[model samples]
Target: ALAYAAQAFQIPCVVVIREDAQLTKLQAIRRYGAEIVLVPLAEWQQRLELEQQRRNLHLVHPFDDPAVAAGQGTVGLEILDAIPDLRTLIVPVGGGGLIAGIAVAIKAQRPNLRIIGVEPEGAPVVSESLAAGHPVAPSRLDSIADGLGAPYTRAFNLSLIERFVDQMRTVSDDAIIEALKAVAQQAKLVVEPAGAAAVAALLADAEIERPVAAVLSGGNVDMDRLGSWLTR
Candidate 1:
């Protein structure tokens, strides 16, 4: 989305993505006309530094950057503006960036409103960190939601979550798949597993406060996997 935003103003955009990431995400990035660099999973971090240094470009952290958080917070503002009576805000948690941003925005204005975060059961990084009172990297992350496959949560987003988020919940892959189908069937939104995560929480649990707003964050689903995903 940022890449597309940059493209509108003809800003030079370079995206460094893990080589093992899903092709659909890469396609979306490419669609925005960003120079896409495929970096090895282990070497991407170091490569990003070098790439930035080589071009004197300001590196943008996906979910850990302050600007990114501020931008994401607009989603919360929009939701609040559209639904003045919104009581619960359910957002999907990966590195906790989106939820962190929204929590800050909503909690600042509506302190009593609930801020719930949902994560994949296989990669419950933020929830675990909130439980431990600090960030901790899991040894493994195995989830169909590649977008939420961050092995750990960083300080920036974690601090905001620990401060403003009301609760963190996790949903199973099966539940996520169901949520994806439900979104397509009911909401008419074809969302990816990560995008379906918050909806999954609402579907799996009946305790969510009504007048809820769930942010369907991304829609970059692999067309090739559409068959298996819809069927499974």
Candidate 2:
């Protein structure tokens, strides 16, 4: 989305992506005319910092920027507009921005509504941070849902999540894949693994409140791996 926006405004966009990122996502970014730099996992941060400094590019923190979060808040507003009687909202958490934004917007109007965040058990940044009562980064990320594999959390978004979000849940890779398949087969939505995290949580736990709405976050799945994921 950011890359597409930059393309529209004729802004030069340089995206520093992990070397292991899904090929389809990379292709999509390139289609928007952004320069792509694939960096190794261990050197991504350093490479990103150097690139920003060299090009004088304004770093758009994926999930930490207030403006970004505010923009995401529109999703919450739309949900409220669509489902006025919504009792529960389940959001997939990557760096907590989407859920933080949605929670603030939803809670402002519906204080009684329950908001839950689900992430991969392999990359449990939000769950761990909530447990420790502060922002925390996992030592390593090991999840199929790379979109939800944010390595760390910052205080800015963490504070909002801690304040507005009701609970954090972790779902296994298997559960996420199953949810992805179910969504494709039943809901007719070809959602990515990260997008299905919320549904995985819903399917895993039967005690969640009724009239619940789960936000499917993304749909850029790697086609090369889709067959194995579904058949396995």
Model 1 lDDT, residue 87, Cα: 91
TM-score of 2: 0.97
Residue runs of model 2 more than 4 Å from their true location after superposition: none
lDDT of 1 by residue, 1-232 (tens): 7689789999999988877778888888889899889987567778888999999998888888888998899899999999999999899998888888889999889999998899898888887887788898855588988788776688889999888998888899999999999998898888888899999999887888889889998898887776688887
Error at 146, model 1, angstroms: 0.9
How well does model 1 score by local distance difference test? Answer: 0.87
lDDT tens per residue, model 2, 1-232? 8899999999999998889889889989999999999997668778888999999999987898898999999999999888888899999999899999999988998999999999898999888888898987775599999998887888888999999999998999999999999998899988889999999999988898888889999989888788788887
Q: Return the number of clashes found in candidate 2.
A: 0
Q: How many residue pairs clash in each candidate at the backbone level?
A: 0, 0
List the RMSD of every prediction in angstroms. 1.4, 1.1
lDDT against the true structure, each candidate? 0.87, 0.90
